[model samples]
Target: MEELAINGGPRIRLKELPSRRDIGSEEMKELVDVIWSGNLNRVGGTKVSAFEKEFAMLYGVKHGVASTSGTASIHVALGAINPEPCSEIITGPISDIGSIVPILWQNCIPVFADVDPETYGLDPEDVERKITDRTVAVIAIHLFGQCCDMDPLLKICREHGLYLIEDASQAHLAEYKGRLAGTMGDLGCFSLQQSKQMTCGDGGITITSNDELAERARLFADKAWPRGQAGDRGYLFLAMNYRMTELQGAVALAQLRKVQDIVARRRRVGDTLTKLLSEVEGVNPPKILPGVKHSYWLYPLTIDTGIIKATPEEFARAVSAEGIPASTGYIKRPLYMFSILKDQATYGSSHCPFDCPRYNRRIQYKEGDCPNAEKVLRELITIPVNEFYTDEDVNDIFRAISKVARYYRENPKA
Candidate 1:
């Protein structure tokens, strides 16, 4: 075996990984247009509306509401649904807090469901198990560019009479059985955050087929003002100012045009890496079930530590030292394990709503709430796969990972 790079041995390729958010002349041109037009805000601007329309059309949705951030998009989407106050929304435990913050902000309960051990998506059976009459919706977050299995989830939502919202923040243009990730649910939200598969620095959009829901989202996004009305009494409901500026819209529009290329390249690099890793003894690749098309935002994989005889963190550090960008765990812990949620840290001590009488049920978050999610977070490693990587870059990744795994396998006690 080749000497380990971390131990003063010949190393794999030392070239830098691609920069995040590959902006070019296209993005520059869009920015220039935004400045020249001087219509910065979405209130009376054409860029935001145009981007919204085009984005919605991309997913075959009827309407799209642009917002300031991914979290704001979720907030507006939830407000549009206007579920019974203090009701519960079920979601996966392993995802960005952005997926659940809107629930807490809306004064609603976020009940977490365990994820599939292989796919790292919500286990549909577990989601069904967690549902109660108080459950009004399910936010299926497609983590790491793969679409969560939607058929069973959709059936469960339909039977339970709950709205299904697809959190496609990481999954841009991903497909489950040929249907787009965001298109499978009642409402689909995408974040064009800087690190996502697509980006406009920081922005988000919510898409829906329901005209009424779309209108409500639009109203909620812009402070509940009636758009283009005859009378001056425009306030229909108290809502947030989650508007996206035309500049962001312009950049997002350009990004949207390039999304297909980005997603395809990521898939290519990720699949190649997966095949390469599969040849290694203990490394597990991100699972892509037969028909599901993963966009590969970040190539997430789990190590079979039983065979590797190395912890996730150790493996990550060794591989990173070998010049591959890898890390152990996605977030610090499962969403529920966070101090804010576990200790009911909301509204500063009051825990209002959680402690409020209106909800009428005592709520508590526990560490064991989603066991599978907990296990995965502790055992997973994330390797970023950007679109800018060439075939050579992918080959280097394969060599780096293979070398690291071989060293670990041979020195189980080390």
Candidate 2:
């Protein structure tokens, strides 16, 4: 057929790929209410508490604790559970720094576990192997809005008496086998970073049904003070201040109301693009396991380099040349390979956490530790499937991918 777009063929001439974080009159109205209330911090504000209650109820949980950022949410979760200092918390190797920073913050060891190649999630078997006498918790991250297979993970937790937490930072309103994400675990945390489908610039929440954990999370998020209470505040637990502002809460509440529609649009467009790309040789769409409902945060396409004769970076360049925005890899490498963990460089060279004698094991972060994650990252190409993208935008992405794929297959170069 047609000539490849990378070879002087027509490109998707649009100035922008898609406009996301859609704010409107409704959002402004909510902000105005917060502004007039004159309460900036949630410690004495109404919006934060209202949003937390609504969000927790939506996930079928009894309580929610709003925090300053996603990392703060995790830190609060860890603090609430009080996982032993210098103990181990096993987590998937592939994720944002937020996933591991909390583990380090708690003076705990961050045990690296390989991910399931198909879902790019925590592999239960590897997780089981990583557990030890010091293993106190499991942080299962539902990366890119796709839930991890939770049954096995739950089983592992129950068998070991370890706490299981869900890092649903990228997975709002995502369901796994009819049950909503973050509900199956002991506690679930979500990020409201601007780039996420639901955002308030920067904020986070921790949800749990356990009354004790809920109480602790609330206290921890607000510097161990009894929030929603007046007079003679007592510091219950050793904690830090990570409170969300009224402004963030107002906008986040508005965004939360639109999450269902936003998630649906992303899934629809992502599925449609996958449907078209599936027929194209050398292109493999993201894998949605049986009974899994994926809320597409970022659409990942794995290219079979053997057939395409091109690396993920090269293929992404070709596609981008055609005006479709795509990136070769999500992160530079697995979390462990980074300097913070590799050389035990945390805590300003003291390595207090990793160096703690209670953490007796000599941790190392060499290559080949997480082979699956490493391989998947290399072959992965990420495309934004934001809610703002329409069918036309999806079609354009499809054509760009197809053009580059076929061209690379035939030419084996460029």
Number of the top-ranking candidate, with lDDT as the measure: 1
User: Residues 1-414, candidate 1, lDDT per residue (tens digit)?
Assistant: 677776777768687888656778998898898889877887777888899999988889899999998888889889899987789999998888899899988889999999998899889999999998799999999999888889999999999899999999999999999899888989999898999988888999999999999989999998898877898958899899999999998899888899988899999999889988899889999888778988998999888877787888888877887888899889969999887688888897678668878888887888888888988899899998889999989988888887888888888643
Q: Output the worst ten-in-a-row residue range by lDDT, candidate 2.
A: 1-10
Q: What is the RMSD of candidate 1? A: 1.1
C-alpha lDDT score of every prediction, in listed order: 0.88, 0.87
Question: Which regions of candidate 1 deviate over 4 angstroms?
Answer: none
TM-score of each: 0.98, 0.97
Model 2 alpha-carbon miss at residue 99, Å? 0.8
lDDT of 1: 0.88
> Which residue window of length 10 is worst by lDDT in model 1?
405-414
lDDT of 2 by residue, 146-243 (tens): 99999999999999999999999988888888888888899999989988878899999999999999888888887787755678788887898998
Q: Model 2 has how many clashing residue pairs?
A: 0
Error of 1 at 378 (Å): 0.6
Misplaced by over 4 Å in model 2 are 228-231
